[model samples]
Target: MIELEGLTKRYGEKVAVNHLTFTVRPGVVTGFLGPNGAGKSTTMRMLLGLDHPTAGDVRIDGRHYEQIRHPLKYIGALLDAKAMHGGRSAFNHLLCLAQSNGIPKSRVAEVLDTVGLTAVARKKAKGFSLGMGQRLGIAGALLGDPQILMFDEPVNGLDPEGIHWIRNLMKGLAAQGRTVFVSSHLMSEMALTADHLVVIGQGRLLADTSMADFIRENSRSYVRLRSPQQERLRDVLGQAGVPAVEAGSGILEVDGARSELIGELAAEHHLVLHELSPQQASLEEAFMQLTAESVEYHAHSDTGPPDTNGWAGGTGTEAVSGGGWGEQWAREQRKRKAGG
Candidate 1:
C-alpha cells in the first residue's frame, strides 16, 4: 500500500500539492484524476523521490522511495513513455534499467515479452511508434516484478487493440494483489478499469471514493420513458404528481423516481410503454459536474470564439451558454429543416 500523510509540495511561492492525505490500498486499481496543472504529475514525481516535498511524508509500501532497497523491485512506475534514449534499442533500454536496479538480465526478456515488445527488442527506440514506445515503458516498469505499479497515461497513442491489452494488463496486475495506481484523463477508460478514484483540483483534493459512489454523488439520476402516447402519458403523470420534462422525440424524463414506480404507473394508466429505463449519469458527466469550477482552461465551441470587438455586418445577439446554447441550437436546426 501507498500512504500519504499531509502530503504537500511547493515550487517557489506557488503551492503545487496541498496538505493531502490518502491511502492507496492493494488489490484494486486506483485512478488519480485532476485537470491540467492540478499537480498530479508533481505529486507522482514526489512519490518517486524525483522531487522533495516541502512539508509532508509519502511512503511507498511502508517506506520512503529513497529508503527502500532496490526500489524498482518494490515500486515501479511509467511516468513518460518517451523518456528513453532514442539511440538505444528496446532490449538495451530495459536492460539498462534492470542493470541499475540489480535485477537479473533474464527478467528483462520476461518483461519485454510481457509488454509484447519481444519481437522489436532489437529495434531502435527512435524508430518505434508511439504505441511501441508506450509498451517499452511498460516493459521497463515490469522489469523487477514490483509489487506496486504506477502509470501516467499508459494508453497514450495506442490503437484500440493496444488499449484493450493495457487495460487487461493493469487489471491482471491488481488481481495478483499488487497496488496499481494510474493517472489518466480518459474518464471512459478509467470508468472501466479503476474500482477506486482520487480526484484533485487546483492542487487540492476534491474526492476519494469508489467509481460508483463518485458518480452517484456528483451526477443526477433520472428515469427516461418513451411512449407512443406521450401526450396522454404526460397528463397521466401530471395527475399522478410526478413531474416529467419532455426530453425530445416522444421521451419523458422524470427525476427522483424509480423504474418500478414508472412501470406501475404506466400500466395503471393503460399507456403503451415503448421504453422505460433508469438513466444513471455517465462518468464523463459526473467528472464534468464535479470539476467544472476547477477547470483552468476552457475551449470555445465550434460556433467560434467570443466576439470581444464589434465586427462589421454581424448580428447584435450572440448565442447564450448552458440551456440557452441548446435552445439556440435547436432553433437553428428547425430553421435548416424548414430550408431557411
Candidate 2:
C-alpha cells in the first residue's frame, strides 16, 4: 500500500503539490487523474524520493521510500519510458539493472518475455517505437518482481493493441494482490482499468473515492421527456414541483422527479408522449463542472473576435463524447436510472 499524508511541494513562488493526503490500497488499480500540470509527476517524484517534499511524508508499506533498503524489490515504477540509455539493447539494459540490484540475469529474460519484448531483446532501445519503449520500461519495472507498481501515462502514445495490453496487464497485476497505481490524462482508460480514483486539480485533492461514487456524486441526473404538446407537458411538469429545462424542440429535461412519477403525471394529463428517457450527466461533464474553475491555464482568442467553435473542440466536445472519456461514467449513469 502507498500512503501520502499532508504532502506538499513548492518551486520558488509556485506550489506544485499542496497539502494532500490519500492512500492507495493493495489488490486494486488506483487511478491518479488530473489535467496537465496538476503536479501528478511531481507527486510521483516525491514518492520515489527523486524530489524532497516541502512538507509531510509519503510511505510505502509503512516505510518511507528512502528508508527502505532494496527499495526496487519492494516497489517498481516506470516514471519515464525514455529514461533508458538509447544505445543499450533492451536485454542489456535490464541486465545492467539486474546486476546492480543483485537480480539474477535469468530474471531479465523473464521480464522481457513478460512484456512481450523478448523478440527485440537484442535491439537498440533508440530504434524502438514509442509503444516498444513503453514495453521496455514496464519490463524493467517488473524486473524486481515488486508487489507495488506505479506507472505514469503507460499508454500515452500506444496504439490500440498496446493500450489493450497494458490495461490487461495492470488488471492482472491487481488481481494477483499487487498494488497498482497508474496516472493518466485519459479518463476513458481509467474508467475501464481503475477500481478507485484519486482526482486532483492545481495540486489540491479534489476527490478520493470509488470510481462509481465519484461519478454518481458529481453527475446531475435528469429525466428526459418528449411530447407532441411540449409546452403543456412542460407546464404540467413545472406544476408538479419538478425542475424542467427545454433540452430541444418538444423535449424537456426534468429533474427531482422519478420516471414512474413523470409517467403517472403524463398519463393523468392525457399527454401524447413520444419519448420518455432519463439522462444522467457523463463523467467528463462532471469533471469539467467540478474542475472548470480550477483549470490552471486558459486560452484566449486574439483580435477580440469571438471563436464560436471554441467550445466545439474544447470541454464541451469532451462532455458530448459520453463513453469515449470513460465507460464507467456511462455505465454508472445507466445503473442509476435503471434502478428506478
User: lDDT winner among the candidates?
Assistant: 2
- Where is model 2 more than 4 Å wrong at Cα? 227-229, 270-274, 293-313, 317-340
Tens digits of per-residue lDDT, candidate 2, 1-340, equal 9999999999997788999999999999999988667789999999999999999999999998889877778889999989899999999999998888789999999999998999999999999998899999999899999999999999977899999999999999999999999998767778889999998876889889999998888887888887889888888988988767886666788774388898998999999888888777767666665554332222121122223232222544544331222222333355589997
**Can you list the residue pairs that collide in candidate 1?**
none
In model 2, residue pairs whose N, Cα or C atoms come closer than 3 Å (at least 3 residues apart or on different chains), thus clashing, are 188-325
Task: Give one digit per residue, the lDDT tens place, for model 1 in 1-340.
Answer: 9998889998887788998889898999999986556678888999999999998999987889999979889888999988999999998998888999899999988998888888889989999999999999998888889999999888888999999999999999999999999998667889999999998765778789998899888777899999999999888888888888998888899986478887998999899999998887778667765654332222232343322222110222222122211222343465588996
Pick out the ten consecutive residues of candidate 2 with the lowest summed lDDT: 296-305
Clashes of 2: 1
lDDT of each structure? 0.81, 0.82
**For residue 168, what is the lDDT in candidate 2?**
96
lDDT of 1 at 299: 25
